[model samples]
Target: MNINSIKIATVTAGYVAGVWVLCSIAVVIAPDTLRYISGAMMHLDLSQWDWEMGMDTFVVGLLAWSFFSWVTVWCIVTLYQYSLRSFS
Candidate 1:
């Protein structure tokens, strides 16, 4: 729609990605790193030797994935909108 809108879109995407990264790191180091805070260290008993992470880690990973997904969607949307405005 406009430069301001594009900027907002990028900022939103960046924020989401940033949060996703933080959460992902949390998941990787979680339960232990997350201990004494957002609940107990409930991962070691679960994901220690697992090929894939346990359910908890998987869920956090999903959240991280969503950020990337949303960023892509928003970027596309913003570009489409901008194109329509400039071309029309």
Candidate 2:
């Protein structure tokens, strides 16, 4: 089956944006929990690190991450389509 790269990328980007919004809210509501989770993921101590989120940083991060996710998914889908055509 062929996949629509644009649609799939948009959906993936939307999903990532939603997660980013939730994470931003989580950071405001439960920063310590986020810090702990981040620390665990990184396998390092982040308790003493300063957690700062400015409006500019948040907006930039949201845009950057969403765009990055969209591009990544688009590329993957395009590659998959190419591989399917190549193999069959």
Candidate 3:
């Protein structure tokens, strides 16, 4: 089966953006809980990690992460397509 790389990338990016917004909301609502969860997941102390939830920082991070996710997924799909052709 062939996959539409652009469509998949767009969808993945949108999903990531949605998740980012939700996480931002969570950070605003329960920062300490989020920090603890993150620390536990990474097995590192994030108590000293300062979180700057400025508007500018949030906007920039959202854009940068979405774009990064789009590019990464697009590349992966393209490579998968190439591998399928090579194997066939």
Best by lDDT: 3
lDDT of 3 by residue, 1-88 (tens): 9999999999999999999999999998999999999899999999999778889988998999899999999999999999999999
Shift in Å, residue 62, candidate 3 = 0.5
In candidate 1 the C-alpha lDDT for residue 53 amounts to 52
Between candidates 2 and 3, which one is better according to lDDT?
A: 3
Which portions of model 3 show Cα errors greater than 4 Å?
A: none
Considering summed lDDT, which 10 consecutive residues are worst modelled in model 2? Answer: 49-58
Candidate 1 lDDT over residue span 32-58, tens digit each: 444444434543343333334577766
Candidate 1 vs candidate 3, lDDT winner: 3
After the best TM-score superposition of candidate 2, give how far the Cα of residue 49 lies from its true spot, in angstroms: 0.8
In candidate 2, position 82 carries an lDDT of 100
Report RMSD (Å) for each prediction in the order shown. Answer: 8.3, 0.7, 0.9
| Comparing 1 and 2 on lDDT, the stronger one | 2
Residue runs of model 2 more than 4 Å from their true location after superposition: none
lDDT of 2 by residue, 36-83 (tens): 999999999999997787788789889999999999999999999999
Candidate 2 TM-score over all chains jointly = 0.96
Model 1 has a clash total of 1
